[model samples]
Target: MKYNNYYFKLKSYARNYNINPQTKKYYNLDFAYLVELSKLDMYIRKIILELSLDVEHYLKVRLLNDLSDNSKEDGYNIVGLFLQYHRNAGADIQSKADKYSFCSDLAEKHLDEYKEPKKLAVWNIVELLSFGNFMELYELYYQTYPSFNYSDYLKSIKFIRNAAAHNNCILSTLRKPNSLKKFSKTKKLANILGKIPEFRELENRDAMMRNPVIHDFVTLLFVYNDVMKVSATKNVRNKKMEEIRHLFCDEDGRIRKNKIYFEKNPYIKESYSFICSIIKYIDKKNKNPKHTNFLQ
Candidate 1:
């Protein structure tokens, strides 16, 4: 395989850390680990970008539905609550504002920018809000939706996101190459979480939790499926999984008969099956045709 995408992105990131000739020192360049990390970061960035867009869209609809008058003032006040909540939790509001300004400027024509706040759009509002704060707003404002522990889900999503964004070493298997200890522990934790009656029947629970990265992807799939088209989200997920498998795995690592060879890494197979299970569950349960129209 050419590995064009991973090759280019990793090379691009590598350019930033050039070693100075004057202060030459041994640089243990783990090319393989760096490639893997790059791949994980690429996939996670896509997932987070998609999820953020979907959540922002949903919030727009939810706000318009919940608030009788979604004017510039009403929208600003409601979104201010999210910013305040995040600020109260010790987040640097100034940094967030900078990001908001940058993304908003780039996406100015497409976004519904608020004149009063000068480049503040609905997307910008949600963009500045942390996942935890956004979840708080979701729970408090969106009363019609079934509320789970948003904080728990937010923690997992944000933790993995920050690790990838900051280029942290997140691959347990890569670090501890010879052992499957983390894999086993992941399975146990997944099974315990999946035991909830709501998803008790979720298949391949053990396999789904075999890898931490895969588990995070599953969390993303669940959220995307709920907020977007079930079929579309599932298809996007399957496509990404296929790309990852081809990029990172040998032919032996591929799934057959809904199973991966234990000797080969089963994380991809388990993760795919887990996502498929959630998609199936959603399809079965979402009987209301009206629910499919998320924009409405």
Candidate 2:
């Protein structure tokens, strides 16, 4: 109830234009659709923090690791900091479990059918990861929503989410979120020209997210944390991007790292670029809000 109230209050704040998280640059808005977007951002931040805690718990106890309770203090510092700063938290111990109950239930049913966890690979479980009654969600899901130019942006993020869910490195407190490419993937990525390169993309190898119907806290934490709320100028595309020189990255032939063989990973770089563009768009929104708070 507290978190729910808090979430709603934050939603109100955004709607009033009382708080614009952005710096002075540009993507600001006097009249903006803040409620849904703010809620979404808050939801994601909460998820990542929660998932980090889950990861620590799994590594210290569930995985049969040698570390003892005293020896390992949530090995990863990510949650430790989050827990320290944010007053908001899930109400109960099982709150995380409850949030993911749908996925777990589907996992159980599927696992029961197989009668063995070994048979259920991470890739095999995407159907189970559906949001609500996962089956219906899966039926309508599309890998590439081509209708939206930013479909590719969504695709890149989906890959990161899948990676966080499946990879052990992501789950362990011992591991860090430094390398975006390290996140697991369903299969080897196909090479697309300049848009995406193979070697640097998740190391250009196929991988699975993770198996087991039940997930540790870390999976949820990573998912929530990584899903950032973007407050960008609404409705800007590649064609419009050229007109605004300031918003674009000043690559200026300074050895475009993007050009280098990202043989190791492109997840972070790709995702970062997308996020920056969104931020720029937000500036545009701020500059030209449909309603002028101050008389024109």
User: Would you estimate the TM-scores of all the predictions?
Assistant: 0.46, 0.21
Candidate 2's residue-wise lDDT over 1-296, tens digit each? 35543444443433222233566321233222233334333433443333343323332222122212323333333222322333232122123234566455544544333333223322333333322222221222222111211112223333334544443222111112334354332222122211233223442122112221012222232222222212331233222333322323455422132323222223423433443443353344345636221101
> In model 2, what is the error at residue 136, expressed in angstroms?
44
Q: RMSD to native for every prediction?
A: 10.4, 21.1
Q: Per model, how many backbone clashes are there?
A: 0, 25
lDDT of 1 by residue, 250-276 (tens): 244322222322223343334445555
